[model samples]
Target: MRAYMQGGGFVVEVDPDEIEAFSSRWPCSNLTVTSGKEFLFSAENGDILDAATVSRGRRFSTEADDGSALAALADDACRFGAQALSLTDVLAIRFPDLAQAAPRP
Candidate 1:
């Protein structure tokens, strides 16, 4: 995962290869959901700030991708500030069910 501040806003990009590699090893079901749970707990405890406005990006290709993941990251960035986040965080935010299914260590 790549995260940085750009154009006065935060940006996070998860590499497709990373996703594949991680899934091959831990799998979402094998990896524990500690990070996701911790993040949510922190957010509930007032660690996260208010959400920011997210704008839809114009589709550059005819692919069926809806960019919901991108929007989820934007919302988190706005709420959590520019602190570093991980692939698990992204997955947790975008695919809560998968994260919740993560195996306990």
Candidate 2:
């Protein structure tokens, strides 16, 4: 998807088909349900941490808006495995980017 700055904030575009392919029986947020898609967040200036510097501020980032929070969710799914997670947990944590991109539900 194209990435760029708009009005001093970062923007990320997502493909709807990819979104559905990624999640199936796992429940989605009201936002995702209504929009029928998932979102990813980005920053206008840049990522909070350069991957090379991913260690220093790896904790839950305050900048982790809705879109970015999905990264955390993906992390959870990876770290714990799909069967281990519930729809609520995935829907609860707001990826910064997703939050912004998620159409108000």
Candidate 3:
């Protein structure tokens, strides 16, 4: 995953094909009554990546591709909410194309 920040906005970019693989590893919500669960992503570098799940309840226990948020991404969310967050080397991403620019691991 690639992360960055710009204009005080958090940004995270992952490969489109990586979504399914990532989601399977990190399940977001299991609520079925039109409820919503939030994801918080924070990294050792103080980078936060946050993405909210689709506003409706899920029919199954599976999470959506876009439902998962990186620990590194949550830092921004925490900060955006005016809450306390801790991490180092923070990076707020505004451009998603960095996903492509990111080095392959």
lDDT per prediction? 0.34, 0.31, 0.36
Give the winner by lDDT. 3
Q: What global local distance difference test value does model 3 have? A: 0.36
How high is each candidate's TM-score? 0.28, 0.28, 0.29
Instruction: Supply the global lDDT for candidate 2.
Output: 0.31
Note the residue pairs that clash in candidate 1. Answer: none
User: What C-alpha lDDT does candidate 1 achieve relative to the native structure?
Assistant: 0.34
State the weakest 10-residue window (summed lDDT) of model 1: 32-41
All candidates: CA RMSD (Å): 12.8, 16.2, 11.1
Query: Which candidate model has the greater lDDT, 2 or 3?
Result: 3
lDDT of 2 by residue, 13-94 (tens): 3333433444453355211321222222223212322111112333223232245434533343222221122222223343
Clashes of 1: 0
Whichever of 1 and 3 has more lDDT, that candidate is 3
Candidate 1 local lDDT, 1-105, one digit each (tens): 445444423444433343344345433333211121111213222223222221242213212222444334334433333235323443466445545654433
Clash totals for all candidate models? 0, 19, 20
